[model samples]
Structure formats: C-alpha cells, structure tokens
Target: MTRILVVGATGLVGREIVRKALRDDRITRLIAPTRRPLEPHPKLHNPLVDFDRLPEDAGWWAVNSVICVLGTTRAKAGSDQAFRKVDYDYPLAVARLAHRHGAMRFALNSSLGAAAAPRLLYSRTKGEIEAAITAVGFSSLTIVRPGLIGGDRNEFRAGEWIAARVLGALGPLLPRRFRISPAPKIADALVEAAIAGASGVHLIEADQLAAD
Candidate 1:
C-alpha cells in the first residue's frame, strides 16, 4: 500500500497517470494537488491549490513517491516568465516539499532533447528542472523523456498536431526514438518507476519508451 503524489494530474499524460495510479493495486493512496478539483475517487485525495501560494506545511505532502507531469508551452503560458514558472519553478517546489516530507522516489515527465545547456527555451527549462529535482536528494529519481506524445488533448497544439501527423505518416521509417510516444505509454513508465521505487537515477529515453 504505497502512497504517491501526482502533480499536473489534469493534463493529457498526467490524466492518464492519475487514472492508471488509481486503478493500480500497488498504490493505496494518490494525492493530486491541482488548481481545480479532480473527480472524486476512493483512493484519491484531491486538494485544490494555487501554485503561487502552495501550502508549505500541508499534510498531503507526505507520500512514498511523487510523479510530476507539470509542464506548459511558451505559447500557452503567454510569456517566458510564466512558462518558466510552470515548467521549472512549480515542479521543483513540489519535489522539494515532497522530499522534505519523506518521499523517496520521484518521476519526472521530461522532453526528448532536454539538456543543461540548450538553444531552445523549452529544452533548457526541462534540463534545469531535471537538475533542480536531482538536487532534492530523492533516493530514486526517474526521468522519462518522451518525444512527440500522441493523444487527444483538450487544447489544440498546432505544432504538436502537425508534428504528430508527420511522424505518424513516417511511422517505422523513422527511428524508434523519433517516433510518436503515446501518452499512456509515458504514463505507464512514470507509474512503474514510482511504484517500483528503483534505486539511483534512471533515464527512460524516447527509444526505450517505444519498447513497452
């Protein structure tokens, strides 16, 4: 009966993770703190929260593991600062809080080309958050870097939609690493890593994501 926390549980991949976590026998408790309320579930403890004013001493922070699918696009965020707040600041804050509350395992849904130093703002933010979370001292850290995640998003992403079409047409012609990564597959990886609580640091790359 493992207790787990899932941030960004409202998004595409996050929603999938939440659904799977709730159904999973391994997880006994699922804490999802979101801007809006999530559908009630017996195993789930949904907390309405404001990211800018996260309650530092909340009891819900106590969990065995945490999976962060918290991320946003520059366009959607409207500004570079806003984008950074979501992609970098919020996840790291959750990691620190969860780690302080004794969460040993942490799983992050990151992008394919994340790097410490990158030309793109999106990749750079992802890399920075990855580094930030690593410093939080979680015993088990899993970073799942997925590429071109395929799913029916509530909001339309022109670039992702276009890319998905192109990649879908390319199909097996492209390398496994470059292929479309289904949202559920990525969700499964995050859930597995969180529940398994594997030791040390692990990076599940796009190619590996395509495998199972």
Candidate 2:
C-alpha cells in the first residue's frame, strides 16, 4: 500500500496519471491537490490549493512518491512570469514539501529540449526547475521529457490542438522522438518507475516514454 502525491491533477497528463494510479493495486492512496476540485474517488483525496501559496500543513506531504505533471503555456498563463510560476515555482515547491514529508521518489513531466543552455525561455525555465528538484536529494528521481502530448486536454490551447491534429495525420512521417505521446503512456511510465523502486536520477526521453 503506497501513498502517492500528485500535483496538477486537473490537467491532461495529470488527470490520466491520477486515473491510472487509482486503478493500480500497488497504490493505497492518492493525495491530489489542484487549483480546482475534481470528482470524488474512494482512493483519492483531492484538495484545492493555490499554487502561489500552498497550505502550511505538514501532513499534506506524507506520501511514498510525488508525481508532478504541472505546466502551462505563455498564452494561457498571460505572461512569461506567470508561466514560470506554474511551470517552475509551483512544482519545485511541491517537491520540497514532499521531500520534507518523507517522500523518497519524484517523477517530473518536463518538456522536450529542456536544457539550461537553451536560448528559449520555456526550455531554460524547465531545465532550471529539473535541476532544482534534483538538488533536493530525493532517494530516486525520474525526469520524463515528453514531446507533444496527445490527449483530450481540459483547457483550450489552439496551437497545441492544431499541432496534435496535424501531427496525428502525419504520424508515420514524424520522427519517433517528435511523435505525439499519448497521456496514458506517460502515466504508465510514471507509475512503473515508482513501482520499480529504481534509485538515483533517471532521464526518460520522448522515444522511451512513448515506448513505455
């Protein structure tokens, strides 16, 4: 019976991860905190939390592993700073709290081409967040760098929707690394990584994530 903490449970990838984890026999309980409330579940405890200001309760951090699929685009977030707050700050804060509350493993849903050296602001921010979480000294850390995620999303992002449709049509022509990754696949990988009990840091690229 493993207790898990999931952030951003309202998003596309996050929602799938939550659904999958609930069905897993290995998981005893799931503590999912988001800005909005989710449907009630027997194995889930959903708490509405503000990303800019997390609750001070230390009990919220008690879990076996922390899975973060939290992210937002500039258009939705309104500005670069707002996007960074969701993509970088919120996840890092959750990781820190999880570490303090005795969680051992952390699985992050980072984007492709996330590098500290990159000129792109989004990439740089993601890379920085990855580095920060790694430095938190978790017993095991799994960083998944997925390409364009293909799934029914909650929010309306025209660019992503168009990309998914176009890429889906040209699936065979697209490179394996750039292929649209199903949310279910990524969710399965995250759960598997936690169940495997692998130690140290692991970087799962797009191809490997898709295969999983």
Best by TM-score: 1
Cα lDDT of model 1 overall? Answer: 0.92
The list of candidate 2 runs beyond 4 A from truth reads none
Query: How many clashes in each candidate?
Result: 0, 0
The digit string of per-residue lDDT tens for model 2 on 1-212 reads 78999997888888888889889999999999988888999999988887778885658689999999988888878998999999999998999888988999999999888994578888999899999999999999999898899887767778888988887888878778888888888888887776665899998889875522
For model 1 the local lDDT of residue 18 reads 89
Per-residue error for 59 in candidate 2, Å, reads 1.1
How high is each candidate's TM-score?
A: 0.97, 0.94
Candidate 2 CA-lDDT value: 0.86
Question: CA lDDT of 49 in candidate 1?
Answer: 94
| Pairs of residues at least 3 apart in sequence or in different chains that clash in candidate 2 | none
TM-score of 2: 0.94
TM-score of 1: 0.97
